[model samples]
Target: MSPKASTRVARGIITFLFIYLATPIVVTMIYSFSTSWVKTILPNGLTLKWYSELVASPEFMAVLLRSFSLGLLTTLIAMACFLPVVFYANVYNPQVKSHLRFITVLPFTIPGIILVTGLIQLYAELPIPKIIILVLAISLLSLPLTYQALDNAFIGRDFRAMFEQALVLGDSPFKAFVKVIIPNIRAGVLVAMLLTFTSAFGEYVLTNLLLGGNFETLKIYMYRLMRSNGQASSVLTTIYFIFLAFISLILILIMQHYSAPHKSTKEGAKK
Candidate 1:
């Protein structure tokens, strides 16, 4: 095929792919605005009643708060607990770095239900509270995602150069990590937080199985209300989607801002 023809075909394909992916999301957003329930094709009217009702409901508010709290806690804990160790593995321990990767990924090999079941069984025999166990389980499940993000960021890094520079400047490894490495991997850390938070926010199987109706998350609330076909459930789902979208938007903005400085610095050095 001619170059012009091939370019036109590729553009067509790209447009079609975007539309295909966006169709469902667009439909859901429209449905969230619908005023009528059980419509065959689409609602005849659009109104904000559903959204207002959702916001006014105490149950939904509490559940959303809980979900946010848990997700944030999980993200923070995962970052704190994993960063130093993984950074050390990559920078210092050449032999064990490969083994550590496998160990981190092992949890992903098990089915979520089975993992949750095992956690519940183990928790029953231990002295810790169920809530703590549930949090730990969720954090464990989230580690692989964080590890992958941070590990990729750590790759192509010049640890030796960074350390030597820091030493010449009379800075410690910890200080260098804080000053240089952290800024460089801001994008990866944002990705890790987004992934971990989203996963923890939507994790119904593990939370439901572990808590057994004793605690309710946003996902659990949505699941329980799903069969009723209530407007409240739809509104709740819409709110959750909105929250997730906002987070993604913020992460994107952070990546843009965090990346711009580094690019500017590189160009300055070149000049």
Candidate 2:
């Protein structure tokens, strides 16, 4: 085939893939606006009644708040607990890097249901809420994603040199971490937080099994609506998608802003 013909074929494939991926989200957005979509190829009309009702729902409000709060807490807790550990593994002990990577990835090897079952069995006698248990489980599951992001940042450079330079300049360990390291790894840290928060936010299997009806998250709320009211569920999904998109955009902008100085200077030096 001619080069132009091959290019046309590639463009067609790309267009097809984009539409294939976006079709579900587009369909859901349309359905969310439908006034009455039953037995129709196209919605008869469009209205915001479903969304308005959803917004006014106290149960949904509670679920939304809980999901956001839980996701944020998961991010915060993972960063606090994992950053130092990952830094140590990557920068301090080369021998532990392989072992640490294996440990972080263990969560992905186990089926979520099995994992949840194990947690329930182990914590059956604990006096804590199932929600806390679910949070811990989700955080564990997100470990690989969070750790990999930070580890990639650490691997591309010599953090020990930066640390020693700070010490030589009379900065304390904490001051060195704050002044030199944190800013350098800001993008990686933000990426980790975004990944972990989104992962925990959307996790349903573990949430369903561990908490059941005792603690309701947005996922649980959506599942309930899905059983009773499909249209309401569609609206809820649209709202959830919008919320995720908005937060992702905000996080990406912050990451880019922090990354700008280092990215530009590094690229310039490379050239």
Candidate 3:
């Protein structure tokens, strides 16, 4: 085929794929707003009642708060545990990255059920709060994503030289990292944090098993709704989809914002 025809065919396929994937989500969103969608070609009526009812519930607010707290705490813990280690691995000792690669297969190697069972066995009788244990476990699960994102941020940059220069300029190592490296990799850090938070926020298995549905995060609440109320559950699912879309939009904006300067600099060099 001619190059132009080949490109046109690829574009056609991509458009079809996009529509194929988006159709269900679009239908779900419509259903969330429908008064009654059962046994019909279309909704009987469109109403905001479902969304309003969901948003107005105290339980909804509580569940949202719980999920947000879990997401935030997990993100913080993941950042603290992985950021410096990732920095050292990428900048000073690339060899450490080889050992760390094992982390990428963590979920496959140790499934959530197995991990939760082990946690229960070890910490079930401990004096410490299970919430804390839960947070730590989620953080551990998120490390592979955190590590990879932060590791990628170090690419195409002379971080060792940057760090050494900062050190030579009389800044302490922590201060230098905070002042220098963090700004440079802010985009990646934001992406990593968002991914970590999203993972923890929607986490069902660990939260459900560990807290025994007593914690009632968003996912657990959604599960409960799913069993009892299809309309409400659809509303919740639509909201979750919106939240994910928002996160994705933020990530795309961050990438574009950060890349613009590099693109301009490269163009200037080429000129």
Which residue ranges in model 1 land beyond 4 Å of their true spot? 1-20, 37-42, 164-176, 254-271
Candidate 3 lDDT over 1-271, as tens digits, reads 9999999999999999999999989998899999999898999999999999999999999999999999999999999989988899999999988888886657657989999999889987889899999999999988888888888899998999999999999999999999899988888899999999999999988998899768999999998998998889989999999999999999899888788866647756988
Clashing pairs in 2: none
Query: Model 2: how far is 10 from its true place, Å?
Result: 1.8
Give the Å error, residue 262, model 1. 4.1
Order of candidate numbers by lDDT, starting with the best? 3, 2, 1
Candidate 2 per-residue lDDT over residues 97-214, each given as its tens digit? 8898899989989998899889888999989777788888888999999988889778567898998899999999989998888877887888899899998887788888887787
Clashing pairs in 3: none
Q: What tens-digit string does per-residue lDDT give for candidate 1 at 206-262?
A: 888888678899999998877875666666777777888898898788667656746
Candidate of highest TM-score: 3
TM-score of 1: 0.84
True-vs-predicted CA distance for residue 44, candidate 2, Å = 1.3
The total of clashing pairs for model 3 equals 0
